[model samples]
Target: MATRKAIVVGSGAAGLTAGWRLAQAGWQVELLGPEAQVGGLLAPQPVAGWPCDLGAHRLHAPALQVPAVAELAQRIPLEKRRRRGLVLVGGRSFNYPLRLTDLAQGLGLRGGGELLGSLVHARLSGRHWERQRAPEPQSDIGFGEFVRSRSGEAAYRAFYRPYADKVWGLDPAELSQSCAKQRVSSSAPWQLLWRPQRGEFLHPRGGFGAWMDGLAQLATQSGARVTLCQLSLQHGDLANLDADAVVHTGHLSAALTPDQQLAAQLDHRGLFLLWLVVADGQPGPVDTWYTPEAQFWFGRVSEVGNFLGHPHGRGRVLCVEIPQGRHAADRDFTGDLGELRRQLAQAKILSREAEVSEVVQRFLPAVYPLFRRGWLPRWRLALRHACASGRLWPAGRQGLWLHCNLDHAMASAEDAVRHVASGGASTQWPELAERWSEVRVRD
Candidate 1:
């Protein structure tokens, strides 16, 4: 149906970026996605009067500074703002990211000693911290085990495990080290041991969907064709697609046939976002907070209206994040606010009583890709070989079979464009392989 074109298979951050890059490089690109909305996991869903994001969709400082990501964010109007964060530990609340003063004075002597000792242990394990060639089979070990060995059990249990568990919906032992390498700072020894200055998250003036749609418009306007509801992989339609190269940037399983090993690594999880619209005009303290305590049904909670500017000075919008398990199917936050309210009240975190406005749940089959041990070497090799073969190239979180933030996904597009510009030459696949092989947790 098209000549000398590139096809990208997902509409999320990865697919959109790949399409835009190739289109800008003078290739006619067709972007395919199942959802009508372009931004995949990055897109926002409406809750009450505000946007409730299931993923940590905010652009952190280090990620925001990336030129490509910054360029994308600038497409929409955004405000530079900061919100207070708190961590509830030992029945007390302390400033999150562990401010120096809070750690020194707030945590008291014993907690401070343990935290300092943990930092020291991390520094001592030079191999573990730097992510160097592991003395132990690095890939086979789970993230929790690795952290415990290097950073001490307290740090892993008190801080890393709970926070990561809330986001990934799996125990640290189940997730691979590669899945989280990019998110954490250096594990290097002899480094100044303190929490780095926390980065801020972005909130679009209107909603996250508006920002995603803006990018989608750019891709389509640049001779990039987009199709929705075409979820067949039988290759029957392959005869209809006449393209020099194809960028399979959608979900790995959806874009590629299920016979591939890369597709086999997909990790599915359930997400429940409970939005509480308080009539008293009071919201939660922090923009976002993670809960690992089993007593609480929700893992993390955030206040949207406060995070996004309170333009109208209206009521507050609170979003609670919960992972899906067997009990998730029948869980009702609307009727379960009694538990949430009780927690907040017990902690003295909220003065006024909060009420539930709406509840939203999404069960994602492959929300994240876990780069387990014995997995990356082969998967990476296959993708490299596939790209060289010219018919298949990975895109997005699942496509690449790596864990990447929004910025990294966009960076992937830049790499895809470089490959497309080569015009399907055999030399191009080697070059593409080199580029993909270089992909790390960060850009």
Candidate 2:
């Protein structure tokens, strides 16, 4: 009997996983990506004469939900990188997943005292005391109001407000509850004041994206044919072929159309990355630094040497991530690093002797979905429109438009398999599908 043919588009984690799964399940699958190398943004490109990634990327909290990814990681050269994370506030550092004491410390003696008082006041007011506070008896509010009501205006102004504005590229008030819950959370201030712990951190031996080629090999060995190419639908990236089914693993907005064009265009945020190679040594208290302060344009910085143990032929690499674009039309994708060298020197993260060996600026347009205020309604609407397309199954962060880890991306592909087997009518692949038009959709 002839094999059941399938075509997988975009060779990112999601695409590779989907293609591999479909092939293992007795389907003839072909995987294609925009680059000769797999891994869209996640691919670990060589920077500063060693194997480094776009920024400090890691696989946190393994997805037991997807056995394939979990199994693959175990079999692969994934080393456990146990580095601490800290918050840089007003030039002071504090532990992350933030404990009450740390929060107080980050706020400093004066601001800390006020935050503690506010927490006490909110606690006494009995607003968030209930496990479930019935209903607001009012219309839905936004992230700003949610934080204020749960904690107090003081905490919101001190932390939540600035943090939200800095990291999300939008004011808390302008962000919807759904986006907030998806990103931060809507819990009351007192409840969230305590520390939040993160899961294990994993990185590949060579680099995070290094595993893509291996995955392609594994899938091929398992009977799937993996091909590499610069592909897109409109420009005929895949113009030569037709198959029984097409598994879209790139940006869903590319395949999802006319009806959702507005939402698709408006919902995603472009990502800007700046990678600097430090000759001296590791900097900062942790492997990753999260600063929401106005002074630091980049929200987070990750030291690669701390994770991979300072590879040969290069100095320690520091990857700084600016949450949004500086200007609307900045033309630097991977350009000069001299401009930001002063900022790094001032912060002391980079030493006076440390020379900026190389700078790689990657501007990924629409890499993240803007989980903005009231974005839930339009997101659901858009997903519904895309899912109704039937043949095209969108998977992964870019495809699903959700903020997720590598595990979620792999699991999303697992879900996509169920949809492929059922010819897109499966209850799984698209998130809001099963609950479509139900109370959940409206919610």
lDDT of 2: 0.65
Worst 10 residues of 2 by lDDT: 434-443
lDDT of 2 by residue, 1-443 (tens): 67778888888888888888898888988887778787877787676766667666776553544686776776676777775877776677766655666777667788888888888877777655343332222333777876677677777776677767665667677665544444554334465555355634677777766677777777787787777766566413332347766677677666555556665444666657777776655454468777767776677777877666546554577888776634443656354355466556656567667766667777667665665555555656666666564566667776776666666777777777777876555223456332211111100
Candidate 1 accuracy as lDDT:
0.60
Clashes of each: 3, 6
The global C-alpha lDDT for each of the candidates, from Candidate 1 onward, is: 0.60, 0.65
Best by lDDT: 2
- Residue 92, model 1: Cα distance from true site in angstroms: 2.0
Tens-place lDDT per residue, model 1, 1-443, is 34466777778777887787778777777787878666777677776656556544466566676555777677786665575666566666766554544653566788767866776676566545555533234355767766676666656666667656665657677766654454443422123345465555566666667778887887887778888765744223432456666676654544334465344465455566666666456654466664555556665567776566663345776666666633445566566666767775665544444554445555454554544445555564455544544565665565665556667777776666665676555235534443443344421
**Positional deviation of 299 in candidate 2, in angstroms?**
0.5
Best candidate according to TM-score: 2
